[model samples]
Target: MSNLQAVLKQYWGYDQFRPVQEEAIRSVLEGNDTLLLLPTGGGKSICFQVPVMTMEGVCIVVTPLIALMKDQVEQLKRRDISAAAIHSGMNRHEIDITLDNCIHGQTKFLYVSPERLRTEIMIERTKQMKVCLLAVDEAHCISAWGYDFRPSYLLISEFRLLIPKVPVMALTATATEQVQIDIIDKLEMKPVRVFRQSFARANLSYSTFLEENKERKLLQILKNVPGTAIVYVRTRKRTKELADWLTKQGLRAAGYNAGLPFKERSDRQTAWLKNQVRVVVATNAFGMGIDKPDVRAVVHFDLPDNLEAYYQEAGRAGRDEKKAFAVALFNKIDLEDLAENVEKKYPAMDVLRRVYQSLANYYKIHVGGGEFSAYDFDIQNFTGTFGLIVNETHYALKLLEEEGFIQLSENFNNPARLHFEVDNRQLYDFQIRNPEFDTFVKLLLRIYGGELFTEYVRISESELAQIYFVPELEILKKLSFLKERGIADYEPRRDKPQLTFLTPRYDAALLPLNVFEIERRRERDRQKARAVIQYASNKNRCRTILLLEYFNEMDGKDCGVCDVCLKNKKNEPRPEIDEELGNQILHYLKSFGAVTPRALSQIFENVAEKPFLQTLRYLIDEEIINYDQVGKLTLNSKYHS
Candidate 1:
């Protein structure tokens, strides 16, 4: 076996590759630029991961989400592979050490944010390292036609120029044909090998339930389906409220959102993964890095902003190849609400510029200052003070961030950080002098490794409290005491989102808002909104067919199990029973023997279809007639000559 194949077996325990995985791996190994258009749960990572294991040097993976990067790096480590990630949440020293590891240590993969590619440290260090491959996760974000575009992603092409020999492999779970072409052109992929798996998912039964009381329908669905499920809502408040409602209904459930502390989110996610919780009611933040395979249902409590997001979310169901459902509960009010949301999401360029200037002013940053500075952001306070609508202000800030002027990270519960200030001898001497703090200090040294002496380590106060059988607050106070004594440096975690300036502050009047680009994106969003609305309101076509057609697949067959197909089947006319038709059916059966439903329909030329079917069914039910194993009509013995 080839080394790559052997490595894949060793790591993933798979004897063979999925549809396009082997081909993609081969393309990358051949030093050709490849774009993998795999669906969610299609194992896009394996296509790049397996090839990296076979080759030498580090693989640089540029991704957008910090949580996802960490999750992937952790998974790689669990498989005994060397990997590390650098994101905005990490302090400069932590990032510096991680980069140093990539350059000098035995690290095989380095996951970084797109913005980090432009940093001086990264630029200088990566030049010294041997980079084998460039893998861009969520490559669609580089295209305007994509649903989520980040201006920082465009910087990837310039970075590629610095290492012209390294082949680029872009992968995304969701992308249209236009987005695919745009990815190739934007990333400057040469002689690209495009691998697209069909977007159709036959295991997922897509349905829409139209009811004024969506909560009621949701409860009914949960009761009927009886497996793990996810209910997606738009706002963070609804996530908690709906989760409470589900709990009241006596199902183990939890709310997941960006606002929760990191520890709470981790606990809830672990509970859900372990089947301790039956459902997770959450916003869009909940599902990106989750890999649950037995989720029987994924319901949309509110209308999604676009079809791309909707498809990716709904596709989370039926990953185990078992029967599952993707349901959307909507009312007429939801349609109106969606329109308003679209307007709020795409504020005018002037509003975006105003929000930018206000942010700078809020941070007390001058026009020529604030380069690469991080500021704690309170959305409610900022909006209230400026008299700006909360939703509009949030959306405006997101647009500004996407334009590369600033980088915004929502509330991610980064753990508290600690590093020892004194070496072992001095700390031991201090511990001997202060016996009250000795046990705690000893625990810190024992639990965290010696790395705490050189760099900060993310420490868990709750874990410490559990170990010592004390309150978390007590542990925090002890840590504070140690820090005050100059034994260690500690930084507690923040519970709010942060905004970092990507460039020095620019004057508000000449902030360079791309008017044409912004307007074009707004139009695209409008089109996407209309498409999703149409998908929900549609009652004639199969839901699967509609979704497939939107992704440019016209050859998809009708999924005979969707709500529309089932309703149509229920409405189809059926033949009725009558004495005259009954006699005719019996006589024809006696003469010609058994016939199939289609043939019987054709034989009764004078009789209407439904009436003929009704007669045939009635005779069979009466025992005066019957059909043989092969469906041949037969008279009972009493009627036989």
Candidate 2:
């Protein structure tokens, strides 16, 4: 075996390469700036880790997902691979210890968020260290045109400059050709080896169901796939609600979203990971750091505005080289709701101005006041207090954050959790008497070896429970026992928090009313959403073909497996709509005002050919005219014309 492969097997227990993982690792080992475009669930970590093992200095991996960073760090420590994670969750002392370890000890991997690099001390730490490589996970976030872009990622070039010779590996699961270029430009990578795997998961069956009763449809999909499952929703409340409802249907289910208290969230996640919970219904926030291998299906309860977000979230279903189902549940109304969300994501200038005004008012600062003021603004409550729409207000707040008006705090309430509460001896001792809890406790001890004796370790027990099922109480009791005996200390979990932009602390007048930036951001995001909508609604080829083509690969053929192929199999003829007649019918309705589709269809009946009739039927089918609960046509979403 190669030295890196030996290290991978010795530490991670994997004997062979995972497709492109070994190649990515070799690229990093060869001191090249490698851009790895693996699909979601492809092993992106080993690309940097194996290289770090072969190199001389610490690997600085900047990842935006806090849960992801903590998860990977814990995994490394479990394998006795010296690693540590630093993020906003850490206090001064925690930061001091972690940096001290990196500086003074044999730490191989240092995981962090891009936002954390803005600090003077963090930058100084990198400058002081003998850095081997800078691996930017989710590298697409650097692009403004990319889904989930963070402006803070722009500071990475400065980080690269701090340690000039370090080769940077930019890794992401999803990126369009445009996003790929933007990522390269933003990260300032050297002309690099770009390893892009085909953006196709042959194991995953893609199906989109157009049903108004989406909730019922989701339950039906669940019934078909019986193993570990994840149901992705857009909101935290919905995550819990769906889980709770599914559980009531006798399906051992639970919801995971940002709304759960920290301890409860960890406990629920741990349960899902252990197969104690059959299904996990969660918001997009839940899966970044989770790595359970047996998930049989992933169901999307709401349509994501863009495919990048969809691919990453849906891609979570299967990682064990097994069959998995990726089902998208949608109704015509979901498209409308999705459009509204995209609209709301980009704040209007008026709303942005109101937010600045409100923050100033909240802090009792005048136009030229409140410079560097740090406040945790809750979007729902904040908007409701001022009679502004929640979506509009939140969009405005995000704009402020992007413009450097404020530093947004995402989750201060649900602090990071760790499983390591004691060292090998103590944890080994605890597991001895608790023979009943042996496997669970040992898994905890093995996986989360870092920070077992320090302050409370933040952990997601769910991933650990992936190998064994145990109650949170069972894990907590051991932690509490250790704390009581002074073997380990534990802090119970609290909440998942949402933080907002840092307002002008005292310099209110200096806050730039940048209408240009806000509008530009809105346009960029909307254009992304428009592309996904256009692609999905196209009729010329297989739905899978369109998706593969979008990723810039040319050899893709009709998969003979997607919705379009199925329609073809059933002899569902392409409904030809007469554009001229359709336009005339719509125009006539607009001229007369508030006519039903039945009336419009009748008005054009004499002129209607088979195609025209089909077009008229398609219009009614699409609700170009509004459909009542009784199926009568009326006006909604747009004018008939």
Candidate 3:
């Protein structure tokens, strides 16, 4: 037996390991705290998957995204591996069974949300389980200092204390040096092995275009490129529109969004991955835990929130490592719109409180009544009725949830799954005894079991429907039936896009909040928006360089294959331009004090085509235009001289 071949063939059906997968697996099997820093689509799962089989106990993977946990467990179960997840979405029975199973080591991998580790039941059960390793996915979220902060992540350290000997492996696609340090400090893992794969993708090419006809550019790509593609947009509305546009342009494409019923999204994603649908136009909500290797391209219709998110999203392409393309198309107006969107999202305390109050009234909530209540939130529906921007209103709702005013149905946020070992005949007989379980049993019959028997599964009505030939509403109905029956427990799902309302009674002045933390979060969101803008607008550095620097890696050589480097030359300075374009740039400098490449392009919109680009290139070559490290331009010293 090749050392790595035992479980790889017995369980996973892989002949050999991808670059570092074997080493990572060996480290963990050797009982070490291993941090695997692989690029997105670098087979992060197998590192943990391989060792779980060799070990004699359960391997608990702490994941942040409910969908991600569900998808992973689903895939594992497909391969006959036993796994399950315990997260916020499930009812008490589901969690109890999963936890009990973990305790008995019936499950190999038991998935749980970071927040679940904080719960009394989870912690108590975790104490009993013979844990092989504590795998933390999206490990960067634990850092309140990082771009995305979840207070629930703070509970991870508590789990660390619960199982002192259990090794912890924290994994994320994009974490800067600061975020990485915070993950180690926050988790307090001593003597961990930090494994990093090179961030560079030699087979992929990067290109960013400021095009007026963004959709047309996308269409052109679809027409020219062959194989599966993922086009990312910023919102649900855009996901729909772009998908339709691509399909109309003769590309077999579909939309994926958080607002989509889980079933439809799953079917569409499946079709795309199976090569039935040639393209998938989706919001950023898609692409986590997706393992389509032959994707020909990843097209960004809007700027991403940060270099980290962008890298992970873009990395979704070319997973088979045959040549693939990553393209970001933007306009100046989108950048402006992005900034305004940021301002609206970080609403004032009064605005947040007011929105909370409105939600309570809408739901007819009263004091001490939030404990067992559930509500469905519609962004356009709720915001329009309340006279608020949907973006801003959603942000306020999230804050309310964090303050423990009320629990929200995280949009399809089933972090865990629950199932039992009842015989099919028993389940059917129970349906006769308990007619309510009928639909749920029918639904259960449609699914292949991994989540229930192996580990936990993610619970989402719509996602379940996609695997079967059923409607999304029917899927929800079955789960709802199970939830009500007390025989089966299912998570209260936000299968479609939604914001959960917290607090039984929302009062304007009485809600307890950390003023500094709220403001700090607001600042962090703004910083992310700026990063989104900067990534789309920057024209000076190699796309690869911009990403590497963001991750705190310096003194790195450029990837000569990217658009910026290949279109020009390696490390060659920018060009100088003639007077008219230089004058227009100077005028922009005088007007805005400083302007971005995208911002500057907007100022001379009257000029046809690439005139401004040609002019700017000349000015840059002449050293008449000077840009900062972040690509903010100013009047060059030599321009005045």
Using lDDT, give the best candidate's number.
Answer: 1
| Candidate 2's TM-score | 0.74
Per-candidate RMSD, Å:
8.1, 15.1, 13.4
Q: What is the lDDT of residue 352 in candidate 3?
A: 76
Cα-based TM-score, every candidate: 0.84, 0.74, 0.76
**Measured by C-alpha RMSD in angstroms, how accurate is candidate 1?**
8.1
Residue 205, model 1: Cα distance from true site in angstroms: 0.2
Name the runs in model 1 displaced over 4 angstroms: 418-445, 450-456, 465-490, 568-641
Best-matching candidate per TM-score = 1
For model 3, residues 14-51, the per-residue Cα lDDT tens digits are 78788888888888887888888889988788888787
Candidate 3 residue-wise lDDT at 429: 72
Candidate 1 worst ten-residue window by lDDT: 620-629
Instruction: Write down the worst ten-residue block by lDDT for model 2.
Output: 498-507
The digit string of per-residue lDDT tens for model 1 on 1-641 reads 87777988999998888888999999999999999987788889999999999888999999988778978988998899989888766777677767777887568999998988999999999998899999999998999989889888999999998889999999998887898888999899998998878887867888997899999999999999989999999989999999999999999989999888777888999999999999999999988878899999999999898888999999899888677999999999998888777677777878887898888878999998987788778899998888888878888988887788988878454668897878989988998999998888878878997878765677989899999999999999999998898888788876668788988899988998888888888888888889889999999999988988888778988887788987886687744569877877778777877677678777788787677767776676456886665766678768767
lDDT of 2 by residue, 387-474 (tens): 8776666667767777656555554443435434446686678668767657755565566655544434566544444455666566
Would you give me the overall lDDT of model 3? 0.74
Count: clashes, candidate 3: 25
